[model samples]
Target chain A: MLDLSTIREGDSLPTVVKPPISRSTLALFAGGSGDHNPIHIDIDYAKQAGFDDVFAHGMLSMAYLGQLLTNWAPQQALRSYSVRFRAITHIGDEISCSGRVSEVFQENDEPRVRIELTAANQNGDVKLIGEAVIAVY
Target chain B: MIDRSNIGKSFPPYAVEVENHQLRLFAKAIGETNEVYTDEKAAAAQGYSALPAPPTFGFSLSLSKPNVFEAYEALGIDLSRLLHGEQKFDYIAPIHVGDVITLHEKITDIFEKPEKRLEFIVIQTSLVNQHNEHVGEMTNTLVIKN
Candidate 1:
């Protein structure tokens, strides 16, 4: 849980950097997420679809952002989350998830915080941008 | 082109049981080190009745239908050209292992940008547990290249 007394509007959350997305990770995520889109796992299919190789799933990047949130506060504290896919995450790209407190306020007599999130690759190309609302003590 | 007439069409509700093993696998796949997602004892220590499903784990449950692409297929969407454009989740209650979640999904909107050669389909899903309590809702947007 976040310390409401210390958390400021612009406080940065700890960054979560993931290892380079590998073919094996992609394959495992397919079975785990139940998102077996061929574009994310089959290189031959990707080539047929006009790409050089298979890429990572947009949900996978969102999952990483989810981790970034849960790392700061428990999963149960999350009230809402949303994301927009900005760019494709190609294979072997190392994704770094970062976020900051965008606002702090009270709702329904409970304290809450809104966070702005971003997932980017080693090349500085942002793959996803997101926002999340969490209840605070 | 997607049939705009299909908007507001709701699919048959489907139910999925949250299993501990599935939670463990998903946590591992996402590189999550939180023991509360895998170890029952650790989860209890944290006040969870059982292993708590990780954030975004609901997406996997939503895809558990026998034909994952049934809605898209019925909408005349070419699966090969589809891409996930956006996703939003509103968490109403904490989902845990052993909960049976029934998902009610529907096509909320369908539109296109001819000049941009893009077509968009928006799907909204409401999740309710066996006890009839609303657990969460998901809104997913799929973009198709023309």
Candidate 2:
């Protein structure tokens, strides 16, 4: 459990890494997210589309970042979470998400914290990067 | 090239019913092990009236609209060449299980970078619960590789 009282600016968040994503993970995400874009789950279609092979949904990486946030803070405290897809994450790529406190401030008399976040593959090529603003009080 | 005339267009609003099982499934897919996301008892223990939506849950709910892709097709976009460029969410209020949330999609902006042969369209969707409270807003940018 995260204690807002103990958190300070510049503190590093616990890194969360997911196992290498598989075709089955992408397929399950397709069903769960309602994103049936063949480019994500169908190898032939992905190849036909010029990609080397199927890739995970961009949202999947964003979800990993989200998991990192909610695990360290209260779910209801998230005020904003955003990300930009930087690189394609192919199947079997292990994505690791991490973040650091950017600042601690007050808004409407409530304590808030801003965190800069990143999700990168084993090669260190970032798959996504963004920030999350949370209400810590 | 996608027709630029679709800018500022708004699609009909659609609704998606929040369900605990779906939330649990999504959590599992993303490798989320937090019990609050999958167990009602854990959520209640944490003070949530119901299982609070995972931070990115709104993205999945917004895509459930049946005609979400029709607007892109109408703009002459090649769905296969489309790529997600960016996504942002502003959580104004918590979304709880059992909320029949409505999603309203609006085409906020569209532009192109001729040198890069890329066209970008930004769609913003707002979520309102059955009680008519604004819950969240999600912005998605689709990059069409031209």
Q: Report the number of the highest-lDDT candidate.
A: 1
Point out the worst 10-residue segment of candidate 2 chain B by lDDT: B63-72
Candidate 1 per-residue lDDT over residues B39-122, each given as its tens digit: 889889878998998879888998888888866776787777899999999999989999999999999999999999999999
Worst 10 residues of 1 chain B by lDDT: B70-79
Q: Against the true structure, whose TM-score is highest?
A: 1
Candidate 1: which stretches are off by over 4 Å? none
Against the hidden true structure, what lDDT does model 2 obtain?
A: 0.89
In model 2, which residue pairs have backbone atoms overlapping below 3 Å? none
Q: Residue B64 of candidate 2: its Cα lDDT? A: 80
TM-score of chain B of each: 0.96, 0.94
